[model samples]
Every structure is written in C-alpha cells, then in structure tokens.
Target: MTTSSYLTVKALTKYIKRKFDADPHLREVYVKGELSNVKIHSSGHIYFTLKDDAARITAAMFRTQASKLKFKPEEGMQVYIRGEVNVYESSGIYQLYVQTMEPDGVGGLFVAFNQLKERLQKEGFFNPNFKQPIPKFPNTVGVLTATTGAAIRDICTTINRRYPLAEIVIYPTVVQGENAAPNIVKNIQLANNQQLCDVLIVGRGGGSIEDLWAFNEEIVAQAIFESRIPIISAVGHETDTTIADFVADLRAPTPTAAAELAVPNQHELIQRIISNKSRLQQMTSALVQFERSRLKKLQNAYPLATPERLYRPFIEKIVQLDMQLGRASQMYLMKKYNALQKLDSTIKSHSPKNEIQYNYKQINHMTDLLTRSVLSLLQKKKDQYGANVRTLEALNPLSIMTRGYSVTYKEQQVVKSVTQLSKDEEIDIHFHDGKVQAKIIEIHEGGEK
Candidate 1:
C-alpha cells in the first residue's frame, strides 16, 4: 500500500471527529448515566465518565455549563446531559462535551439531599442541642401546609382525636414547587410573630422526591431551625425523610403522628387523672388516719388527758419554793435578830455610859488615892514641919534665952563672933521672945582677948 493511503493516528482521530461533528444526532446528544471519576478543575470545568451498567463514556462540562448546575456532580451520581459528542485529536479519544446537565430521576435529589444534609450537619444546624423540646400537651398547634392537602386534614383530625383541648391554628402554605420553601419560611416567621401557637407542625403528605423537594430546601430547614417555638417535622410517609426532619425538634413519620406527638390522648389522660385522684384520696385518708391516731395518742398522754397534771409538778414546786422562801425568811430574820443582838452587845460593850461610870469610879478612886497621898504627904510634911519647928524652937535663940541663953546682934544682925562688936556701935540683942537695940560701950575679945 502507498504511504499516503495508510491512515495515521492523527488522520484517524480527525476523521472520527469530523464524522461525529457531521452527525446531527451526535451534535446535540442527550445521555442518561451514572457519573464516575469526577474531577472539578480550578477553572470550573468538570471532567468525568458517564457510565451505565455496561459501558462508559468520557464527558466534560465547561465553566459556563458547570456554573448553571444547581447541584454538584460527584462520583456515582446519575445525571442527564445534553451535549455534543466528538472525538479529540490529541489522545484520539471520543467524549461528550456537555452543554447542559441535570440529575437523573431520584438520584439527583438524593445527591442534593446528602449534600445539604452533610453541610447542615457540619454547621451544627442539625445538632440536637439546638432543638427545642416539644410540649407534652400543647395548648395550640400551628399547622403549616397546603389548606387542601391531606396533611393538614390528617393533622387536624388526629390532634382533635387525640386531644380535643388542643386548638389548631392553620397556616395555609404551598408545600411544593419553587415557592414552597419561601412560603414555609414566611409561615414560620408569621406564626412566631403572632405567638398564636405553642408548637408547630411543618410538613406535607407523601410525594416523590421532586414533589417533596421544598421540604428538603436549606431555607425550609433554616426556618425550622430558627423558629422560637418547637417544630415537629412530618414531611411524608414513614420511609420518607427530609432536611426539615433533621433540623426540627422532633420528627414524625407522618402528619397524623405529628399531631399525636403534639397532644396527649384524652382517654389516657382521663385515666391518669382518675388514677392520680384515687391515689390522692387514698393518701389523704391514710394521712388523716395517721394524724387522728397521733392525736388520739396525744390525747391519751398524761399531760394532754389531764392538763392539771402538767402544771401539778410546777404547782408543787411553787409551794415547795414558797415554804422554802418562808423558812429562808424566818432564818434570815433570826440571823438578823442574832446579828442585832450581837450588834447591841457590841454597842453596849462600846457604850460611853458604862465606860464613863467606870472611868468616873477610876477617877474617884484615883482622886481619893491622890487625896490620901496628898494628905499623907501633907501630914508627913506637917509632922516634919512640927519636928522642924520643935527643933527650930529648941535651936531658937529666944528659947535659949528663955533657957538663960541669948543672941547678941549688932546693926540688926546676929553676931556670931565676939569681934563683931565695935566700940560705941549700935547693937541688938534678941531673945526668943524679944529683941532690944543697945549701944556697946565695951569690947571684949573672946578666948584670944
């Protein structure tokens, strides 16, 4: 074969590309498949493999198309794509250049559901701590659903059946379609603002994923999370779950179940009340009986039965105290009398009357003694005087003269010597009886003369 006749790898690839480009079916091809080996580029291009059970095809979506996607594509995600199928020349590969993409069937919704759930879970929006406790017996239940939907009817009927006392405030809202999420959020806010209901049941009846998609929306979930009142999520059948279910304070399998959760069964409540009343009656009767028994025991007690006995000991004690007081008073008086007697005796002992009398007697005796002493002394002195007088009389010159002896005197002095006389001097001669003056005419010397 000629060298030009044999096709090169580039030529073969270009030929395939041209064939694909020429085919109108391949130009705007629609495909449904599961995504695999997904790669999101920094430039916002998505590269992945579209696969079914039997085969797979490489696919790519540019930034423009990828930006339009409402949900992120991931591995094993089923998607419906409208795009051009062409062959690349570089690696000689055939691939789909996706222009538009959407999730296929329930798989897309599941992806969105899982993605939002994971996101909210990470943000703690679904945390149990943020959940408010549903009232055990709500006085009012606010219903958020379509007015004509079976969910509202079920909720209302169920609540009425369970608890007739619970009032129902209905908030007619669109529970599906694009407007559903915003409407639900608005209703939640309105209910909170009005403060009309104690609890809220946000829900709808059974539906497909697309039909129930509003309940899965982030805004609906956020509204439930932000509600001040407790929310019960009753989105669908028992098998169906939504984002509202995770963020709500409580999740019920159905709207009827939500109503049941919101209120207590009246029959059961009545039975409980009856039981409690019986228990209270029995307890009160027992308490009264116990109190009566206690009172009877008290009444039979010695102090209570005979109240006088209670004070008898005190009365006896008072009588005894009175006797003791009397005895103490008598003893005190006697002691005072004794003290007075002693005081009188001491006063008498210290009395100036007796002392003065004794002192007077002493003074009289001393005076008498002094008088006797003075008399004796006087008598002795008188006797001495008499003796002295007698002696004096005996020694008297007159007496001597009377006894034939005389005193000679000169100039009125007694002359003791014979020389006392001078010739022609005046002299006095004295005797015991008289004295005479005379003139001496002669002098006589004594023995010497």
Candidate 2:
C-alpha cells in the first residue's frame, strides 16, 4: 500500500476534531445527564463525566463560564448542559466543552439556596444563641437599603412616628442585581465600624426572588452574622425569607415592622410612664405612712417612755455580781489557810533533827545485816576448805602408798612392769614417806622367770 493510503494517529485525530468542530449540529448541543467524577480545580476549571443510562461522555467547563453558574456541580446531580463537542488532540478523545449548566428538574438558584443554607447551618451560622438582642430603646437607628425606595421611607416614617428621640442614619446600598451582595456586605461592615447606631435596619422593598437574591448571598449572611450592632432583617414581604433573615439578629415582616422593633413607641412609653408615676407615688405614700407608724410605736415603747426602766436590770445584775465576788473571795481565803496548815504539818514531819535520827537508825540496821551476812559467808568458806582438804588427801599418791601399795622407778621414771628393769639394774622404790634404792637382780615376765 502506498503511504498516502494509510493515516497516522495524529492525522486521524485532526480529521475527527475537524469533523466535530465544523458540523453545525455538534457546534452547539443541549444534553441532559447525570454527573460523575466531578472535579473542581484550583484554577477554576471543572472536569467531569456526563452519563445517561446508555452512554457517557467526558466533559470540561472552563473557569470563565463556570464562574457564572448559580449552583455548584456535584457528582450524581442530574443536570442540563448547553455546550459544543470537541476532540482533545493530545489523547484523540472527544469531550463536551460545557458553556452553561443548570440543574435538571429544579432551578439552579433554588439548588444554590438550599446548598448554602445547609452548609451555613452546619457551621453554626444560624444558631439562635449567637443572635444579639435588639434594643428596646435605641438612641440612633441605622438604615441599610436602597437610597430611593419605599422601604427607606416606611422605615424613617415609622421610627419617627413611634420613637421621636432616636436619630436615623441612612446608609445608601444597592439591594438588587449582580453588584448588590457585595454592596450590602460593605454597608453592613461600614455601619459596624462607625459604631454610630444602637440598632441597624437592613431591608428592601418586596420583589421577585431574583430581585431579592442579594440577601441570600453567603457574604451578606456572614456580614449580618458578624455585625456587633443588632440587625433587624426586613428583606421582603412577610412570606419571602432569605439567608440574611436566618443570620440576622432579628427578622421583621416589613420595613415598618423592623423600625418598630428597633425602638419603643413614644406614645406607649408616655402612657406607661404616667401609670408607673401614679404607682410610684402610691408606693412612696405607703412607705412614708409605714415609717411614721413605726416611729410612733417606738416613741410609745416602755423602755423609751421611762428611761430608768432600761438601766434597772443592769444595776441589779451589777449588785448580784458583786455579792458573788465577795463570797468567792472569802472561799478563796479559807482554802488558802487550810493549805497553809497542811504545809506546816508536812514541814514539821520533814525536819532536819528527825532526818538525822532516821539516818542513825538506818546505819545500825545496815551494820547488823552486814555482820550476819559476813558470818554466814565465813562459815560457808571454812566448810568448803575442809571438804577440799579431804578430797586432796584421798587423791594423794603417798596416801595410796600408805595403803600398802608402792611405786617403783627406774632412772627417775616410774617402772610400770618388770620389763622396765634388766638384770642387775639399779632401781628406786617410793613408799608412803620415803624412797628406797636397790639393784634389780633379775627380769621377770608374768611374775615368773
């Protein structure tokens, strides 16, 4: 085959992309499908897969168009897309270049409203505990709304008619369209920074939901939530609610109602003052009468009427205490005298002359005991010495010799047997009193020769 008969992958991809781009039917198409694998890049592009029951196609939404979207695209959300088909030359894959996307069965705005509401609710933005209480009587009231509108007129007229003392500070704001949300947020923060108002009334005249969308923005809701001054939200006619209504410190049905809530009615206050003044006068009169009666009772008291009656009990108590003190002194003196007499007897018993006599008696008794003990000990020692002398005499060899037994010695050694002596050996014999020397004539064994 010739080279011209075959096509490279790049050539094939270019041909397919050209076919996709030139076709009028594929140039701008509308599709309804469920989203899958949705990815919102940090660069503001969204990449996702769009699928119905039978088929799916890859899709990409660039940042410029995506920024215009009212609601965020999420996985599994059924959506309608108006876009053009194109081929990705790098991978030879076809994808839909999304231009505009909206939720399939509902308005995108409604979806966005619910999504933001649920998110802010979870973040505790709508908690009642964070809500500030509106002032019953404000010195200054701030109005945040369109400069030329019935809302401003109604608020100013209502506040002036009800509470004339309160000063009104009007902050002109954009209450509709694309620039409205940021403008409203700016005025809210500005009023807070000025700190000029005791309470702020933020509202606009009733309109369609699109005309009232500025109040539903998250930034506006955050601004209302963070404001130090209490905010009364009058967004629309009674039935229309916005995110600002939920986040504000208080919500009013209309601008006039918000003004009434901000400050108390002057006529009501005057009537209340008159009623309280009458009640206070009655209370003061009753209190004065009660104090006068108490004074009269105190003046008529028995102790005050007769001054001497108050001190009589004290004088009697002093006399009784004196009598008790006298008795105590006499008892104390008597006890001291008895103790002195007992001490004198003890002193006499322990006299030095008596102590000396007792010592002499003790010396005599000790001498007698020592003499008896020494005599008994001397007799015991004498008996023991005599017994020892008899035992020594019994063990003496001389005594044994005297009993007819004698010891024979040869060469100064005692001869125990006849083998100790040889024939004609000289020998010595020890008797009871003396020793004898003799010569051994013969030797003997077993007493025989």
Candidate 3:
C-alpha cells in the first residue's frame, strides 16, 4: 500500500529490460506469425507487428540486420523470425529485436520475384519490340559468367565445337551473394564499351533461385536492356526465368544452348550454302528455258514470222486495178477504130485526094491524143496507191515509238493518270529498245487539260 512499493514507469521499464536480457529463452527466441503494420524507415530500419489469431508482438529489424535480408517484408506476409525478446526502455514497451526473418512455409525470394515481375511488366520491360535481333553470324561471342564453373566450360566447348571461327571473350563475374548484382552490371557495361563481340551470352549453370539471384537483379536487367550487343540470357534451367531473361535480346534454356544460339553451326551453314547454290542454279536454268520459250513464241507470231502476209491484200488490189485500167484503154481504142472504119466506107462513095489526106491527118492526131490520155490515167492511179501506203507507215505503232516517246506501266497496267498511282509505287517504263524500272517519289492527283 505504500508509495515506496509503487514503481515509476522508467524503473519498471529498466527492470523489465534487464529481466528479458538475463533470461536465456528470451535472449534467443523463435517466432512464426503474419506481419502487420509494417513500416520501413528512412534510416533503413523496419518496424512491424508479428501477429496470429491468439496474440501480437511488436518487432523491429535494425539497418544492419535488415540489409542482410533477401526479401522485403509487407503487411499480412507470413514469416518465421529468429530474434531476442526485449523491452524498449524509452517507450517502456516489450518488443522483439529480429536478427533474421524468412517467409513462413514459402520463399520470400519468390514473392519478391513476383512483385518485381509485375512492376517491370507494367513498365514494358518484357516488350518484344524492344528486343534486338541476334546476329546469325557472330565474329566474336562474349561470355559473362564465373571463369571457373561448368557454365563457362559448357559454353566455351559448345561455341568452339560448333563454330570454330568465332572468338570467345570471357568476362569473369560473381553470380551469387551480396556483390553479384553490381558485378554483373559492370561486366555487361564493360563488354559493350569494348565492342569486341557481335553477341553476348550471359548466364551460369542451373542452381537454386538464391544462387541465380544476380540475374534477377534490376541493375543486371537494365544493363542487359541497354547493351548494344545482343545478349542471350542463360541464367538457370529451362524452367527458371529471371528479370534478365525478360530484358535480354534472347533467352536460352541453358549455358550450352546459349553458346549454340550465339554462333551458327559451321556444318549447318555449309549445307545451307550448298542448298542455296543448287537453288540458284536451278532458278537460272528455269529462267533461261522460260525466256527461250517466250522468244520462240514471238518468232512464230503472225506479224514477225510472215511479214509478206500482211501486204498480200495490197498487192492483189494493185493487180486488179492494173487489169481494169488495161481493159478500159482497149475498149476506148476499139470504139474509135470501129467509128473510123464506118467513116472510111462512107467517104469512099464521094472520095477526093485532098479530102482523104485531111481525114488521115485527123485520125493520126486522135490516136496520139488517146495514147497520151491513157498513160496519164495510169500514172495518177499509181500515185494514189503510193500516197495510201505512206499514210499507213506514218500510223504504225512501232514507227511512233521510234521517236523519243516511252510508255509507263504500274504493276503491269498502263498508267494513264495520276489517280491510278501513289507515292513510292514502282513502275516500268518501256521504250522501243528496252525497259527501265523506276519508283514514284511524289504524287500530284490532277493532270493537264
């Protein structure tokens, strides 16, 4: 009942702190619970509550201990903790000082992986458009991995065996633990700066997620994304994927696969070359045969093969006209001769020497005039036929093309107007002698009136 028996908050707090420190069970404790009211301070300390259905305990992980954690803590996250129970003297409250903590019955790293994956997915880190094309024939292949491991061995062996021509550049890297992320990023930058390799294979042999964590680091992912050289990520087994895998230009299932992807197989390439050579030869032969067939068809065409057939009608017409002219001339001469005979019979009854002489002179003059007129008519018909032939020659299509004119066609159709064409369209210009290919650069829709 005495005031002396009653303890002040400070005194009670000190007693509790000392008592907790002294007890061996409180000094080293184990706890399993769900996290709540989690707060990460600017000073790098984490404050949270460890709660279950029964009770709750206030807990804290200091900067030094928090730095060693593999994953971030969050609200409602189930975790297992190794810590010491103690009372905070200043606050006069009991709290747990966490030394180490991990997710309960689940991997915290996996949780972290999912969170980062979601975030980066939203930021388009895994966009296929951002990926660069891997070189089919790489002169040099850069390998980023631990110098002494199965990963390096497998990669080097595969590359050397498949494509002996490619030079391998090895970048020794730490693939695990605290310093692995930064080291991976540095080597990636170094490889880019050196510009020695056409492509890069970055990875290690299959292992636990913890062992492959360096590839999952954001810095490593960013480095791979920024690399000027195309990178093939081969971090772990086929089933394992990382942030680096998403960001890299390509991903291979394993180290050996990465090497296989980095350089082409010499045997396969040789076979391809041989196949292509055969194909080219076959194509050339086929093309030659096609052109020959086309030329043969042209040679058999009516106009080119039998040019005389085209002029047969004209020749027949000319012959008929000449025959008509001869018949008309003969008819005129016969009629005049008959009239002369009748006149002679009549003149003989009243015949005189002077009269006969005058009639003979008149007959000579008429015969001479008839011959001149028939010759003039034949010459005029010949001139008319010659003029018609000249007109046909002027209208010949081949004759017109012989001038400086050319015909333009787009996609095998005659290009008559600007509306039928568009920018960047390819056209063929045919001249009398040959054909030329051209591309349309600009288009103006209207034409001259």
**Best candidate (score: TM-score):** 2
TM-score of each: 0.58, 0.70, 0.65
Residue 84 shift from truth in candidate 3, angstroms: 1.1
Model 2 clash pairs are none
Question: On lDDT, who's better, 2 or 3?
Answer: 2
Candidate 2 RMSD computed on C-alpha atoms after optimal superposition onto the true structure: 17.0
Candidate 3 lDDT tens digits, 46-84: 999999999999999999999877678989999999999
Sequence-dependent TM-score of model 1: 0.58
Q: What is the alpha-carbon lDDT of model 1 when measured against the actual structure?
A: 0.89
Count of backbone collisions within predicted model 1: 3
Give candidate 3's TM-score: 0.65
lDDT of 1 at 207: 89
Off by over 4 Å in 2: 301-304, 316-449
Candidate rank order under lDDT: 2, 3, 1
lDDT per prediction? Answer: 0.89, 0.94, 0.91
lDDT (Cα, tens digit) per residue for candidate 1, span 236-320: 8999989999999999999999988889999999999999999999999999999999999998897787899778899999999
Checking candidate 3 for backbone clashes, the offending pairs are none
